[model samples]
Target: MVSCPFAVSCWNKSFPGSQSIHTQVLEVWLEKMFGKYSDNKYADIVTLCWALWRARNDVVWEKKYSRVNRVIASAKQYLLRWKCAPVTCSSVLFRFVVEEDGAITWVRPTRNSIKVTVDATLFAERREYGLGIVARDADGLLVEAKIKCYSGTVTVEYVEALGIKEALSWIKNKGWQEVKLESDCLAVVQAIRCTVEMQSSFGQVVADCRRELRDSNSISLLFIKRSANVVTHCFARASHRYPDRTFDWSDIPIEFQDCIQMESI
Candidate 1:
C-alpha cells in the first residue's frame, strides 16, 4: 500500500524528511516512529496512517479520486478528535434500533428535557437551501417544527450549521434552557461540543450556536447517525416546498404530519 501513488504522496507530504523512513519496511518504520514520539503524537501518526489507508481503498475499490489536501486535512481533524475525545467512553441511556427494512429510531429524552433535531439541504442549481428544526418534548410529541429556505447559495456544511443556529434560537426563544440539540452532522456536533474548531463560512454560524449553548449550563449537543434523524431529514428534503415559512403547534405541513404522528405513537 505504501508503494501506491496515493499513499506515497500522503506520506511524503505529511512527513517531510521521511524518504528514508519510506525506504524501510512499513513495520520497521512504524516501530521506529513509535519509539521516537510520545503516546499522543504516536496516536496522531497512527490516525494519519489509517486515514491514508482508507483513502487508498476509496480510490481503488470505490473508483474515486481522493484529493491530497483534503486527505491531509481529514487526517488532522481525526488527530484533533483523538486528542479531544472523552477520557472515559460512557454508555448512553438512549437505545437506537434498526429494523430489517432499515428503519431507525432512538429513545426519547428524559422528563422535563426538550430535544431538538435539525437538518439542512442545499440545491446547487437553484442556489437555494432549506433547514429543518424540530423540537420534541420528553413525551416525544412535536412541540414545534420549522422549515426555512434561503435564496442565496451556501455549502451543505454552512447550512447544517445554520440549522443548529436556528435550533438554538428556537430553544432560547421558548425559554427552554435545559435542552438537547441533536444533528446527524458530525462536524457541526463536534464543533459545538468543543471537540473540533470551526472554520470557513460556517465559523460564525457555529460561533452563534456556541454562544447560545454557553448561555445555559444544561444545554447539550448530540450526534446521531443519519438513519435515526429520519424526520428532520424528511423536513430538510421538503424545505424547498415552503420558502421562508415557520410553523408552530397549530400549523404543520401535511408531508411532515406522518413523521410527527409516527413519532408520537
Candidate 2:
C-alpha cells in the first residue's frame, strides 16, 4: 500500500496496504513469528516506513485501513523487541497533551526549511561508504532525514568529504540560506575551511557544495564528536545492509522510515 510515486520503486508497488497492516497485526498476534523476526526489518523496507506507519497512523487514508493506534503499537513492539517502548517521539506526539498559553509554541509538522547536520563515513571493516543528513527546526525537532549507500568503495577521508558535500547540497536544494554543517570527520572540516582538495570523486562533491553554498553568507561548517552524530551511525549500519538503491525515496523500503525517525531523535 506504499504507493505514491515513491512506492513504485519499492520491490512491488501493487502489494496490498491492508495486507501490510494485516502482517503487522499478525506479527504482534503470533508470538512465534514475532520471536523469529529480529528487527521487523523487511529487506525491501528500510526501517523508515515502520516509523511513518507508527507516528503518522492517525493520518488515515480511506475507510479500509488498519487501526491507527494498533499499527503504532505493533511497530513499536516490533522495533523495541519488547511488548512496548517506554516513550518515543511518536508516542509523545500521539499521547501528550498540554494547554500552554493558548499559543502553539512548537509542533513537528512536516517542515519547509530547517537547519541541518550531515555525516558521512566509510566503514573500515567493509570499505563501503555511508551518507546521512538530518533537518531540524529552530526548536530542534526533526523534519526530514535521509541516508543512502554511497556508490563504489571509497576511502575514509573521501566519505567524510562526501558527507559534508551532501549536507550542503541538501540545504541548497531546500533553499536554505544559513546552515550550520557539522561532521565528525576532521578531514571534512579541513576540506571545507582549509580549502584542501579532497580525493577526486569526493572533491567534486565538495567543490559543488562550496560553489552552491558559497554564494550564501549564512552557511558555516563545524566539527563534532562522532558520538554526537548518531543519525549517520545508523545510516552507516544501514549502508552495510542495503548497499545500494535508486536515489529516489520511492526506490527505498519502509524500514528507512525508522532510520529517519531515529536520526531526528
Candidate 3:
C-alpha cells in the first residue's frame, strides 16, 4: 500500500479508489489477528475482528486488560503441573477374581473406606488409552463400573496416577461426600495418603493434590493388588488396538469406540 504519484498510476487509468487511515490500520491489525487463519480460511473472520476490537476497547477505555499478563499466567500454570509431582515409590498391586457365578462378591479393602479399584493401560502402537474403575456397592455386586479411552501416552506410573485421580474426581465432581478409592499401585496410593514435600518442584505437585484431596472429608485412599480389580483389568486389556470385542454394562462414551471391539455386555 503506497501513497502519492507514480509514473503510471493503475488507479488513474482504471478507476479511483479511496484509502482511509482506519482501513490501513485495520489491515495491520488483522494480520496479527488472523495469521493463523491460513489453516481455517472458512472461519468467521467478522466475529474474530469484532472480538479483537472489543478487547482493544476494554483495554483502552477501561484500562482492564493485558495480553502478556494472561499468557504468562497460563504458562506458569502449565509449568507448575510438571514441577509438582508425587514421589514414585514402589507400588502394591492386588488381583481381582471372577466368581463362578460371574458376579463379583467382594473386594478386600486395604488402608480404608469401601475400596474402589482403578487402572489404566495404553497401547502406543494402537494410539489409544484404556481407563477402568471398579467399586462394590452395598450389595457387593460390583455396583459401579467405568471404562473409557484416552489419547495421551506416558509411563505406567503416570497412567496409574491418572486412573486414581479420575476415580476420586468422579465422586468429588458428582458431590459425593464419602468414598474409598482403591488402586493396585502402592506408590500412588501412598502418595495419595501421606503428604510428600521435598523442596523439589515435583514434590510440590503431589503436595498440592494431597492438600486438595485432604479437604474432602468424604474420601479415603487405599491400596489393593491389581488382581483384586479383575473386571477393570480385563477392560484395560481389552482396550488393545488389534480390533477385538470388549464388554461394559455402562453407557459407553463415543470416544471409547468400544463397539469396534468384541467384548461389551
Name the lDDT of candidate 1: 0.72
Number of the candidate with higher TM-score, 1 or 3: 1
Q: How many backbone clashes does candidate 1 have?
A: 0
Give the winner by lDDT. Answer: 1
Counting clashing residue pairs in each candidate, in order, gives 0, 18, 29
Q: lDDT rank, highest first?
A: 1, 2, 3
Best candidate according to TM-score: 1
Candidate 1 displacement at residue 31 in angstroms = 55
**Which has the better TM-score: candidate 2, or candidate 3?**
2
In the range 1-265, model 3's lDDT, one tens digit per residue, is 2232320132122112222212335566345435534534313343323334454567679996534223222222223333333322332442223111111222443333344667778778866777777654443434456666777666666677777767776666656555767666677656655655556443454565577577788776665544344445655665554223323335443323321121122
Point out the worst 10-residue segment of candidate 1 by lDDT: 94-103
Error of 3 at 88 (Å): 24
lDDT of each: 0.72, 0.52, 0.49
Q: Write model 2 residue lDDT over 1-265, tens digit each, in one string.
A: 2443332323133223323332434345234323444554342243335544443444555433333323442343344333223434454454322221111111222334355556766666665677777666665555556677755677777777776776776677777755666666665565665567666786777777677667777676665545345544555567666554323344444554444443333
lDDT of 1 by residue, 1-265 (tens): 4566777777677765455564447788888667766676676678778888887788779997756655665665455444444422343643333121112344577898888888999888888999888888888888888888889987887899899988888887788857877787776666665745556678878888888887878777777656457668778888888766777657886656655654554
